[model samples]
Target chain A: MERTRKPQQERAKKTVEAIIEAGFMFISRQSKETLTTTKVADIAGVSVGTLYEYFGNKEEILDAMYARFSEDVTAMLREVTPEVIRKTPDQGILHILQHLREMLSRDNQRYLHCAALLSQNLPEQHVAPIRQVLATLSLQYLSRNPEYINLPNLPVMNYIMTHGGIAALVHQLSSDDPMVTFDELSQGLATMARHMIEGSRRDAEQANP
Target chain B: MERTRKPQQERAKKTVEAIIEAGFMFISRQSKETLTTTKVADIAGVSVGTLYEYFGNKEEILDAMYARFSEDVTAMLREVTPEVIRKTPDQGILHILQHLREMLSRDNQRYLHCAALLSQNLPEQHVAPIRQVLATLSLQYLSRNPEYINLPNLPVMNYIMTHGGIAALVHQLSSDDPMVTFDELSQGLATMARHMIEGSRRDAEQANP
Candidate 1:
């Protein structure tokens, strides 16, 4: 069934929010594999029929959760403005990393579910906007730094490395048998980002000179 | 359905080999989602019943293919002996990276599938052995280098960094719109590995001295 018409009324909106909250709470407490619509309804203290009224299925509920997550992350990314990057690149990197770490640590199991969904070959509609936002932000940051200006395809490189690196680190951090402490993983990746930028700058200089 | 008994006769063994070869070929040619027993049997020039006689389902076929891939990778890792590592740590690093690049480039789709499976919270029985083998190899390489011996939790560090880095790179490389060329990615990662090892050694020296 198609998703129930968006909850427009105040009461309906509260019901939707409750269901989404309950969905994320369930994800945090258990693996995605164990989640069921009935369980979500019970957790939300709503009728099963009411839950179905909003979400067509569990996957739809996950899609909604994922959209919320993307919005949260994108909002966080917005805080890393050009001014902040220009003032202190290192601090800016740390800020982003710290926020990400906190987000992942908040509910690691839920984060894993989000990771799995994001990592899949999601439709362009679901993926493109977030990637565009990230790429645009990375471009802004790179352009502000003279050293990074000459790096070939700086925008794409920044997007791939930063996004891929973050995804990998998050996956490791969320795993039951994480190898490194959170501090180590974050520091290591920050170091990597710094070095990659510097390394490419060096390469560009040698090639041009 | 229960999996077929292991082939005891030479002819039956050949049939199983043919089926597995067909399975990998299908995976390489198309996404795993599209693979089916009938298609695999057709590709292998075997009856559908014969395919079922050897494998319980599509997942079992994937499991067999994964085992084969693991064996191939483990064999490559075995070649990174103490002598090779001691002779030139840089060369050993490049060797491993080159082998990984080749394996990934050989069948990008299949590699992605394997990565997804391995990255997930797979059963300990399925994950532990592969991880143990990789960790052992990483430990061997790290220990043979005197500078790395003093690094904190060297074995675990090696495992996490190496595995995480490889996974991140593979994901990027296999992507449709890859950010960096294969040469750049391999070089960048090799540089990261070298720096991380040397950087840790420097820290250790500073702390001890």
Candidate 2:
């Protein structure tokens, strides 16, 4: 019984992954309007009956795709964010931005499509964990750095920074002609962050002196 | 017939406003899914026939509300953003943030509801105009201000600033326990901008020195 159930579960998991992959591929090449059960099944090389057993409707398929997109994106960030916790603010932002863009654009069309899909039907739940991971990691960064810890309203500032950074990235991806380099965009943000840190340090010194 | 048509148009305009107001109010208190045309008519004190004349469905009413929200918000920013063009970066951010918060909080719940509605169904057309306005206004500011003109990729910086600002505000509003004061939020962003300007000026001077 154990051997039979394990093989069946593995097959079910593979089928689900194939269907999600097919749906994602379909949206990339065609308008989302043209997607249907039969098309997805055909692309996935599965029968409609098998598709129905897993997904109740098209939206359920979309939900599955969205879930996978967010999970993969954040997991990538989680692995990379902590590595930069010890870097200066500008360098830290630069590293994360570089890593994220490189990884996403590794499959450029897939990344853009998933990003467009999430933006069109974005859920607050998906955003919360990403920001939280960012905030938590940065909080660790701050506690370790003696100088920046002096900046007033550090928690609030961290909130603004993470949220603002996330916002800027999303805007860039969704904008027309989003062909700019992460180098240029990251420079703008990194420059902004570097100055804030310097100014804060100056203010702290002036107050103490 | 001509005389009757004029009053009919005026009366039609008034009825449409009333229905939109009622629909707006309903969404503020209840879930959007719970809204029905009959309920909107009942709340507006009009017959369902009158509501139907202007709106084909709930989504149409939502579109109308979104149009009004973006128009009014951008209009308010247009009036106020220019007033800060000559001011320093921090001061400019402060004034705009102050004015926006004061005006919106004057009708806080309505503002929140409208913002939520728009965020939930935000169209690119609506966002494009606001960013354009922001970029246009800041381009004027940069042209007028000698120091910031040296910044490489001024257009890109403007794009980042405006989109980042808009996104941050939306995130703030939609955030759980969003009772933060504008002063604090503005300070963080203002500091970031101020330093970027100063840094660019320093870099330019050093390059030519």
Candidate 3:
């Protein structure tokens, strides 16, 4: 009985993984227009019924995929080393840029296309998970710097950097002819981060004085 | 003969204006999904064929309406007083915010709905005019600050801010629950503009030193 149950559970987990992977592939390849349960099931090597059994429908699968992707991003953000945070703003920015370059370069089209679809299609209710992905990454960045705590509205500033910075980068990346090159994008972000740090430092000094 | 023809031409212009105004009203009252040539013609008190005679299609009418809207915005931006630009960052931001509030508040649905429709439905070719709109505004802003001319790769920075800034703002404003309020959004842009100015200043001082 135990051996039969173990095999069944493992098979179920594999099926779910296949479904999620297939959904991501479909979204990346066909954009949002082709995101139907039938196509996903066909891509996953599963029946329509099996797909429905695993996920209520297409939206449910997408929601699960969104949650998983957001969680992965949060996990990556938390993995930033303490030494990286303690470095000067210039050095810290370099490390952050390096990480972003590696991640985005690995799957540029997939990530960029997915982001475009989300920006276009996702409802207000769905925005929170995406925003949380951003807020979590930002909070993690700020956690390493105690000096910035006393600065006026640290979270608002960080939100501007992460959300606004990423928003700008994504728009350029999605454009037919990107004006900002990959290197320039990274450097620009580093510049913004450094300036923001410097501005907060000035605020901190003023508050202390 | 010339005087008689002038009144005829004037009558044609008035008819076209009536069609466009009715089209705008139709889209504002009904959703974009429901907007059609027949419906617009019915509202305009013209035949469907007459509406098509002027517009050729729905997109052409939309383009006309958008062109008018852009002209209004351009006139507003062009009117930015020298004193407004010379003010402190926070105060300058507030000035812009007040203007934005008035523009956005009046017929909020019109701009919001049209923006949503364009980002999703318009083809790649349609984006060029809007991009030009952004470029013109940036050029006007840059020309105001002659000091920024000598910066390395200056056009690239302006492109980032104007193209990326407009894209980010539109996407956020279109979202279900926007991340930034009008005041916050305007201040965020001001902070970025101020930082860019300060960074350029530092670069100049360092270069000359």
Candidate 4:
């Protein structure tokens, strides 16, 4: 009985994963008027009864995807090295953006929902979207901690963080042979952020002097 | 025949324009399996034969739309003030980006094809797409002329020009009330480019010393 239950458990895990993956693929394609349970199950290659066993509805499946992504982003943000950023922020920004690119570069269908949210929410300018939470937090950190990076040009930072940061990541990660690699992309963004910091420094000096 | 011909010509122009507009709307919505002549005529409130009067087929309809948009963009680019860029490149970049935003901000279905190209081409990382011709030209200009905003970080410039420039414009223009106004977006991008210029100037000084 225990051995038989193990196969059932493995099958159940596979079913849930397939359902979530299908959720992103559907959202990405935007193929239908309304994404019904039957449609999702068909894409997932599972029966409607099996889908019902796991998820009550389509929204719950999407919510699960969101939850998984949010947790991953939260964990990623938590892993930032203070020493690296404090010592040399140019490299720090580079490291952070590279880290971002890595997480995005997974190229898995799971986070297609996040990319979908990112692409969708950006046009709507939903400033507090989950994906932008990192950029938003970075801005807050800049305001709080002058030692790391003191930037008065929050608007510019805000623009680049969303457009330059996320757009580059998404575009680069989506393609097989990208125009800019993650390393090059990271270095370039670091250059961008680092230079902006220099400009801010000049501004501070000009005001005080 | 002269008075009768005038009204007939005006109506003909109107019909052609409607068909083009409907073509963009259908492409934008992507609701159907195949974009047939019948579907386009339905959207245009005309018969399929009427659409054929303006164009041969769906491809011709899209091509006409592309041609019109390309000409408009060409005209806009030709109106650039050389003196403005030569004198104050920071302001020059701001002015140019503002000009670009104005052209994009029309919110007309007429140029929705270009916006669609901008959005669709970005994901696949089509480096030399028509939408990026402006950014590409900007980089080429930088390489050719050191007098105006010279920077050795071509990689960074290329990355930001496409992602920062085009993606920001498309996103900002698509929305009704964008978070970053044309002024704000242009100002932010100018700040971004200007700071990098300052950083480059420092690099030049250090290298010379």
Candidate 5:
């Protein structure tokens, strides 16, 4: 069974990748209404039967794309060590925001469009993985900073405010004619994050002292 | 024309009010999919023709509801004078958040569900009126505080950050069993807003000094 399954496993992986890439392409160039499975299968150069063997439907394919995006984000975030955060929190945050902006802006802003579409139908279960990854990274950053360690429920707070605020700003910026430049948007988010960190620290200190 | 129109005018006014009220009731109690004009007319004790006389379709009824919500929000914001902001920005923000929470949470979370549905299909032109009102009020609040005056493009910044952030939080909180309580959410938002205000002030002062 093992000998027979290896080649099939490799082929399945390739098909899945192709389907996701095709789905992203369609979502970027076409409206959400146009992203049907048959069209995606045609774009991927795979048979409709093969596409069904992998994904149950269009939403399933979109979910795969979303998961792929989340993995990419998590991999990038892993590089932001505690040391980088300690030396210069502002630059560290700015760097992360820049990376996010680039990821979301790739391929003539296809990722943003796809993300918007996927988000509308995202199940509650799908939100947890991304949120958990983000919360973990934020907690790691805060834990490295002596001033921020003792803040009550720091990870949860970071998750809600940072994720929620930046996600909102990104969605707004993804529009055809965003009011602020990417630079301004990123800076605003960084400032908000810094304030949340510092404010929590101050509050904790005041309460204890 | 005037001699014959008086009674008709009063009857028309009452019918319009009844339709609007029924629309709101349906939106609050039922999902958007269930909110048909036929149902609304039935609830309002009017014919479908009369409902159509007042509203073109379901979207038109939803739009009317949104307008009413906006009017209520504007009236509340109108009372938040610069003096109120000056005395205590944190409390002022908290008060606004509470008002927003109350408005969104009304009628067993009907307003929020209706808002989510309306926002999904909201036209570009429709967004402007509400954004304009929010920007004007934020500008008034900032103008009263000398520290915030020197920030570049203050009105636009306020619009993007305040609207984007608060809208995001509201959407998250609208979900059942939200991770954070209203108190925590409001405090977190107030903290972020204060930081944005103070952070910008510091950046401006440092640049000039």
Candidate 6:
């Protein structure tokens, strides 16, 4: 019975991993328009019916990939502790940037392309989980030390934190400049956050009236 | 002979315009993945040979559409002069935002979708002409009157004048908040500019030593 259950578990794991690898492969060549169960099955070296047994359709596979990707990103953010962020906002932002760059580099361009496609195509849905992670991380650090940042509207700050950071990341990934190293990308994030903090105080003052 | 030439000229003009419109329609629904010459010809109510006679392939049709669409945007920008930019950057940004909204609104969403698809699939050769037009227009207004602003680095300043301005416009376009009006978009641009300018100055001072 133990041996029977072991085969079943291994088969399920292999099937799920194959579906996700196929999904990434499909997105790399084309944007959201080219995704299909048949294409994924063909790429994954599996029968279309077997693929359907694992996923209802392309959207289900994509949704699963999104959930898995978000979990990975969140895990990276969690590795940067509150103590690390307490040192400075710059350090926090740089740490996150380096972590993202390392993760993207490990896949040799697939992760970067997938991240850009998701951000562009499914902004509303895909942004939510990432935004939640950023908000939790941002608030945890900022609330403990109001000296670094003081603002009236927390939601707007959250918006800037998530969108501005992601925008900088996406720009670096999509740029054709091979000489633009990851250090510059990290510095860009630090610059973005510092600018946001410095400006938000004045905006808060003006909005109060 | 003169009369014959006039009629032939008119027919050629109609065929070119019809092909462009059909390309837009095809991109609006299916995107660049499903783009095909036969489908474009069918939609344009022209023969496949006629389509080929006018342009080489789908890229040629896309090039024509991009040139025309970019000119439309330039014309809209020219409608707002340096004087408008001087009165208030926020007001100027608002005027341009509303103009773009109106321009895309006329097509009832088809143009916006087609434009987004084209942006994704644009050929490398098409970038230079568009950049030249944008840079010439942007420098004509923003660079001529530097006393009105205080950004430190000229290159970064020029970059902000182009990328930051466009980013603000795109953010507003993609926003789901119905309550977020053009005025809010303008204010956002102004806010982005104000912060980045300060940050640039800080970087400049650090670089000088």
Best by TM-score: 2
| Better by lDDT, candidate 3 or 2 | 2
User: What's the CA error at residue A104 for candidate 6, in Å?
Assistant: 1.4
Instruction: Find the number of clashing residue pairs for candidate 2.
Output: 0
DockQ of candidate 1 (2 decimals):
0.19
Q: Comparing candidate 2 with candidate 4, which one achieves the higher DockQ?
A: 2
- lDDT score of residue B116 within candidate 3: 57
Query: What would the per-residue lDDT of candidate 2 be over residues A122-145, giving only the tens digit for each residue?
Result: 666677778767777787787777
Pick the lDDT winner.
Answer: 2
TM-score leaderboard ranking: 2, 5, 1, 3, 6, 4
| Candidate 6 segments exceeding 4 Å error | A1-9, A22-43, A55-68, A78-87, A107-124, A139-142, A146-161, A178-181, A200-209, B1-9, B19-68, B78-99, B105-143, B146-168, B178-180, B202-209
What is the DockQ of the complex in model 2?
Answer: 0.47
- Which digits, one per residue and each the tens of the lDDT, describe model 6 over residues A110-208? 777775465445434665677678878877887777775656434543454455556545554655562245576566556655665677766777787
In model 5, what are the clashing residue pairs, if there are any?
none
In model 6, what are the clashing residue pairs, if there are any? none
Residue-wise C-alpha lDDT for candidate 6, range B1-209, written one tens digit per residue: 22122215788889888999998888878866578999999999999888887786667788888777777766766666554556444455556667767886677775677755544444334443544555665566576656534544444344434544554345445555522455554556556556655666666767884
Candidates 1 and 2, the one with greater TM-score: 2
TM-score of each: 0.73, 0.85, 0.69, 0.67, 0.73, 0.68
Q: Once superposed on the true structure, which residue ranges of model 2 sit more than 4 Å away at CA?
A: A1-8, A30-60, A179-181, B1-8, B32-58, B106-108
Q: Can you list each candidate's DockQ?
A: 0.19, 0.47, 0.18, 0.29, 0.20, 0.16
- For model 3 chain A, give the 10-residue run with minimal summed lDDT: A1-10
Q: Could you give candidate 1's per-residue lDDT for residues B1-209 as a string of tens digits?
A: 44578798999999999999887777656756678899999999999999888898777887887677666666666765554566455566667767766665565545554543333322334444656766776667666756566675454446445555555555565566666666666655566555555555655677898
Model 2 residue B79 CA deviation in Å: 1.8
Classify candidate 1 by CAPRI docking class.
incorrect
Tell me the TM-score of model 4.
0.67
